[model samples]
Target chain A: MKIHIYQIAITLISSLMIFKGFENYIKGKNGQTVLKLLVRIIVWGGMVLIALFPRFTNILASTIGMEGNINAIILTGFILVFLMIFKLLSAIERLEQSLSQVTRNETLKEIKKED
Target chain B: MTYFENSKIFIVIPAFNEETVIQGVIKEVQSAGYENIVVIDDGSSDNTQAKAAELIGKMAFRHKINRGKGGATKTGIEAAKLLGADIIVTIDGDGQHDPKDIAKIIAPILEKKCGVVLGTRLLNPKGMPLWKIFANHFGNFCTWFLFGLWVTDSQSGFRAYSKHAAELINTRADRYEYDSEVIREIHLHKLKFKEIPVAVRYTKYSMGKIHKQGFINGFKTLYKMIWGLIS
Candidate 1:
């Protein structure tokens, strides 16, 4: 029942993150901000719980039918990275769309000048 | 007989670093009696824009940055539409495509046989490189797989489009994959497509360009096609 120094530090940091998330959520003016803040709090809270009670990961692994906690963590991490990549790709797609628009507009202007 | 004399046909030449060939292509298109010609310079570092600019009173649009061939083609098409073009024929700025074929390709669309006229190089692949023939067949296979239609040459850049077909074909591919994407768009929009046998001359320069495009570009286009379909 002895809590490690590292666990205490991680918990404190996670609590601070959760507090910041809540503050942002309360001050958020849009649905996107609120959703982002909520996700941040949940992720930080999960980190804190995992840091304090690492054995919970074993239970999660068992529930998920994984061989070990490491496997479960790896799978979750993979999914998080995958989702992040998809989000980044969507942003890139938007940028590409705007770039194309600008390119089209500029070309149109040039054509007008010639005409 | 002047087939397209009454029709407003715009020849859209999309050029990228084709400083050596752009002027010739423009002159050839003009000499063929097609007055409505637009050369879209796709932001080449070299003198592509300058070469295109040499032709006085020609409609040329210059992109500020390199937006790929697809982006350039789209820009050229937009210019053609602005000029009140009834038929848009997209040809590469490279001198490989015969400007005379513009009339031949548009004939099907003019006759109301198809909404789009695709120039197929497979009919007479005489001087084309071996790699291009292979890449073209591979592209044809992909088109069949994606659209369930067997086309002779799906990746040929020389194609003719009616105003209806050109406006309806919406594609997001900004690179070499745009050719394949155009085929997919034609199928998705249910536009009637006709493939005509056209001759392509493969110079040492064009052969190098084709070899450079090679398999890597083909694979990239396939990946983009899949991405376009799902996303």
Candidate 2:
């Protein structure tokens, strides 16, 4: 099978979308945003690596980072999109956690009988 | 003529994450002589199923994930109808509705005064939050405007449906909007339903866990109701 640049680009985009969605789903389940910066740092580091050394495609593929010269560029784009989704999901998780916590505290306080 | 006698009147309580009140609601409802009461636990992470099971009822159901009140309701109705309930009475599992009022909601249908009965809390909205008051009024007015008929309360969840009415309004929304959608169906199908005065007891606990997004979701509900009306 010829490793066509376009096919590799499409696969990279699709894989990035799946990974990004999976991250959001996990964050959503945990209902927390404390790791958003950590996620951004990792994502940015990966982007920097790809931007600086575009020829490192084969090495990236072996390292499970990325594959193909054209695939690397598409993946870089995909990673940027995923980062935005990660931020959004993390923000939502934080909001949900705070709201649920407030509601929980209120419920506990309401349970106390007034003298 | 007595379906409750020959066949059981399965009271279907559609609950959504109701761990806090399911047990109490189940206990109250179980005290009544009606056999074959089925409770649909709509994907509650809490002890809704366990609490309901402890109430000594015949059967209990649960959804793997939250599908809203409409999903739970459809589950209950389908189960009861499939279980051969002569009549199915849908009441909230939120504990705001009085189990004692169950008889009143179902009586009119049994006696054939109306094909369906909706327990209108028009007189007892005192403890209800202000937003709900406004939303319900808006709903009532919209329903009246569209149907060109008078309905005291359009968003009351405490209601009764004959097997026939149940069969007619088989489709239901998968959200808190079921109440209004059902009313729209009742109007469109030309099915007769009576709005009777029933006392509603609202407490701080119950009020805390109600549909708080009143007017914010009012237009959405209006849209759904109208959609149901047109379709």
Which model scores highest in lDDT? 1
Which candidate should be chosen as best, given TM-score against the real structure?
1
What would the TM-score be for candidate 2 when compared with the true structure?
Answer: 0.62
Segments of candidate 1 deviating more than 4 angstroms: A1-60, A110-115, B1-3, B56-58, B210-212
Cα displacement (angstroms), candidate 1, residue A23, comes to: 15
The TM-score between candidate 1 and the true structure equals 0.82
Q: Model 2 RMSD to the real structure?
A: 14.0
lDDT of 1: 0.82
* Fnat per model, in the order shown: 0.60, 0.00
lDDT of 1 at B56: 34
Clashing pairs in 1: none
- The local distance difference test score of each candidate is 0.82, 0.69
What is the per-residue lDDT of model 1 for residues B1-231, given as tens digits with 9 covering 90 to 100? 555566799889888888888888889988988878888888887888877877835476788998888888988888898788889999988788898888789999889899999999999898887877988898899878986767898888999999999889987878887888888888888899998888897777766664235677778878877766655
Candidate RMSDs in order: 4.6, 14.0
